[model samples]
Target chain A: MMAGSALRRLMAEYKQLTVNPPEGIIAGPINEDNFFEWEAFITGPEGTCFEGGIFPAKLVFPPDYPLSPPKMQFLCEMFHPNIYADGRVCISILHAPGDDPMGYETSAERWSPVQSVEKILLSVVSMLAEPNDESGANVDAAKMWREDREQFNKIAEEIVRKTLDLPPP
Target chain B: MADDASSSSGITGNTVENSINQDELIMKQQREIEKEISETIPLVGEIEELQTLEKEYNEDPIYLLKVKDLSSKYKSIRRTRPDGNCFFRAFSYAYLERLLTDKQEYDKFYEIAKNSKDILVALGFSQFTVEDFYETFMEVIQRVGEHAGSTPDLIETVRMELHDKFNKQGYSDYIVVYLRLITSGQLQTDQEFYQNFIEGPRTVTEFCRQEVEPMYKESDHIHIIALSNALKVCVRVKYMDRGEGSQVIAHDFPEGSTPLVHLLYRPGHYDILYA
Candidate 1:
């Protein structure tokens, strides 16, 4: 039952994305036949360290869709506090529905079935503009973000340059 | 083939694997059983009748003493599923139970609840998503009032509908979900009064977006107060945790009013507490 609903929701979201694409964000499934795995390209939000970069990423939705949040990871290298070294986004919205057992997040900032893909992308864009160093997934990046601004920008700029390269389509 | 593979690994290995799988299966079943217990058992245990809690430690002697004193005051509790929606569930149950005694309050609540859908929609919740919860919430309220008699009968009926789990998505959690949204909306709408209590860096809008809107996010003091204010009813939350006192700290929501709904909040969970 959830599978049917999840698939239907994905289709609707896909339609919305295609019809009215958010600026600096374009996302869709890699395969026409499969809706579960999607590929996305997000242009770095202007006025951020990641500006002028087109970051490629992957989103893999669980069978439950909105009920369970999808996993988002950058295909390109990422150097940010909230994004893990391996490129996974670590925003509170992606966390499962419940209180932060660790007390890092308010219950409301976490996932609910009502959140859509567009919202996730929007949050990702905002996260890029202002990485929440308080609860950083990448400890190194978080430390640099908080303590050494110049170093953080240099590394981010380098990564941004690398992400601008076109991966084979 | 699976059995053969395990058996060929040797008897001791097979036993270890079997035990591991057994433990996992047992834990999984325990979770399901716990859910069932919450759904079916309206009341968990009488205060005096129950034994020492399985999780409490000797390090918290003060808490134990408080528990002892708490049991002396409140005799019983009605357990709601600890599914993060416990606040709304316990509040609704306790509030309705209170409403049974007063027609004026019940009518007032009924009218507000009837019109709450529009407010929820205005707060940006999709009408399609909220319609069932709104209807069922109203239906449950109306059905209980067909003829208000004893509190026991009303509670049993409310438990039946609330715990119906017919559409676990719609009945069990969604109704609670909508109730929470209403409370959040009310809080934001009346930010002038609520802004004083909201903590952390998030603004009222951001707080509602992150904390109040999400389903299964446990409710806080703010949530309780906002919900009470939303429905124009006061709530008394009995803090039964290991606090500095022998008596369960009872705080009335909206600060100074006599409360209609009473709940027991014990660190991450909420349940109904009776006088």
Candidate 2:
């Protein structure tokens, strides 16, 4: 019964996303048969180290959809402060308030029914542009980002190239 | 020594995996606790005599006194699940139950509820999502209103139906979500006025996103005030606490209006009260 409502909302959101695809994000259900799983491709923000790359991610929504936030993970390798080594994204908007695995600031945007798939992807695009170092899912990447900008940019560029199936420069 | 050893090992290979597993474990336990509560308690329980509260507070003189004072004014209580959505659930259930008998108030509420979707959309809420909740909310309201002007027996039957719908998880939570949306809409529409109530640097919209919109987030004074003003309904909450008083303090939402809904506030929970 709960999954029924979740599926309906997912279909509606899928249609909305398709009709007015956000500027840098394209997403849809992985299979027409199962709306629970989605695949999205996000373009790296321009003027950033991740520029010119197409990053793929997977969103696995629970039976309670909008009520609870979906689990988002990058399909390709990511070396961001907020993206875990295993590719799971750790932004605040992906978590409900007080769930606090990462201890996000109180003012950070949280996962609520009003937030849509489009909003999550836009936050991801901005996350790629400016990584928040405080809640580092990838400690090594966060360390590099804080202590050595040049090295961090080099790694980000490699990751960007990797997403595009290009050889490291 | 055991803690030290575990901490040292935690720093070694696969720390990320270990940490993630720990977080998952904590979340799993939280879910289990919630499940236990849900199994033991109904979303909204059947009405019970106010004396039932006395048994729970019999040993404590302060609470016992407060319960006695509460009973003087209110005869019965309808308890809601103490899950964080209790305030919204209890308030809506009590108000709709009242609407079952009051056709005039029902009409007023029905019109406000019917027009709420457009207000939310105008406030930048997505029509797609708001539409589903609005539809369900209207259906429930319409069902309860169907027997509003009928015989006493028919009204009783509709009242049972209202109880059944409130106990159902999907319908009940959807109503709560819709009310939360309306509350959010109210806060945003009067941002300048609401902004003064918020602490720190967060704007009205930010406060709504974090505190008001999320499911399972508890409601506060600001929430009650906004919701009451938005719906044009007044709520009188009788605050019962251990603080230095035998009398349960009654505070109306808008301070001066007659309260159509009476609720008993006990620390973190709210329950419907009947006079």
Candidate 3:
């Protein structure tokens, strides 16, 4: 039932985010009998335009984990303004407090069960270093993050040099 | 809903169209949580004595004379389950239905609800799941302190053991996360009188780690004054919004005290009323 207490609360938040690892994050479970599919990586948040990137994401969780709220994405290529132009991640604590049928977040900034996964990956590295172009969900990256600031740091430094040129699993 | 995986637009493209749109957003969040656990409405109900407010309000005769003067100065209500943890389950079922007939506040809330599991295992919890939510909240206050001489068998044995352990979904989120971890360990061990009633830039340990150990985060006024000063009781509340007249403005939470749960808030629910 309740998918075994949502797999022992995602194995106690994947054993406290693998023994306290929150600086430029890095997560777990691509599989360990699937503690509901996770992945994460994130590093970016140094001196913005995603200095020295890393990205790569996924998450999933909800066979009712922390009573629902977990579906981050960004398996790369995440042009912000609340992420989704594919790589989902539409913030507000991973939505789901009345599953916002577009009443753009309000149930006290959504999600409950005291949100986790290291506070949703430190609120997605402080939402890729602050993006919230007032409710955009990638409206062309919130009109290039509010009208082209040097073409939004040259397309977030070309998706942080294509996430440090992939290749490290 | 598999967290809205419309990993559709910017490719990460079709892995069977993102597993059939994450199985239709996990069946629309499992039919909206099986329609909110099939509408759970009772925890302490059946006390509804009066209500003819012009036939339950056939369009306001001035809000049916303010619900006929608030049912002649409050007489009955007890509801407790709007599911946003209705003011801490109607203030822990009206403080164990008024200590099931007040034997000195049921022996001072059963000696701090039976040593509130060493105050949540000395503020660390996980001693076998907060000792199974402090042994089902001390077997529901020791079956209301062993039916303190029958207040209807201590409200029918704490309403059939709080409806069989709050309908058992991990023991109802370990009984509201063990009363929101004993109201966030007494509001972060009383952080300077609750950090000036936390208005902004949060800190009572980040509002008790995001609005008090968060099961169904709704209670406000700093979670009803940190759950009425962490179970010393006293609640009052009485608001009923859409204000300006109809004088039901109450308020009492440790200010000019008069304890004994009384809720009925109305703007974002909370029930139990009985005067």
lDDT of 1 at A42: 95
- Which candidate's DockQ is highest? 2
The interface RMSD value for candidate 3 stands at 9.3
The number of the candidate with the highest lDDT is 2
| Fnat of candidates, each listed | 0.30, 0.63, 0.17
Model 1 segments more than 4 A misplaced: A1-20, A28-37, A47-49, A62-68, A77-81, A96-115, A132-169, B1-75, B81-84, B96-110, B124-161, B166-170, B199-202, B215-218, B239-260, B266-268
Model 2 Cα displacement at A2 (Å)?
2.2
lDDT of each: 0.73, 0.91, 0.72
Query: What ordering of candidates by DockQ runs from best to worst?
Result: 2, 1, 3
Candidate 2 regions off by >4 Å? B2-35
The whole-model C-alpha lDDT of candidate 2 against the native structure comes to 0.91
Question: Which of candidates 2 and 3 is the stronger one according to lDDT?
Answer: 2
Worst 10 residues of 3 chain A by lDDT: A100-109
Best by TM-score: 2
lDDT leaderboard ranking: 2, 1, 3
By DockQ thresholds, what CAPRI class is model 1? incorrect
All-Cα superposition RMSD per candidate: 9.5, 2.7, 18.4
Interface RMSD for each candidate model?
A: 5.1, 2.4, 9.3
lDDT of 3 by residue, B1-275 (tens): 45445545456435644565566678779867855773765544556664733476778666666666678788777665666677877777667767777778788877876776787667665454455456656776676677754667556766677656655565555557678778887887788988898887767876776666656667788778876787777788888666777766778897787868888787787887888
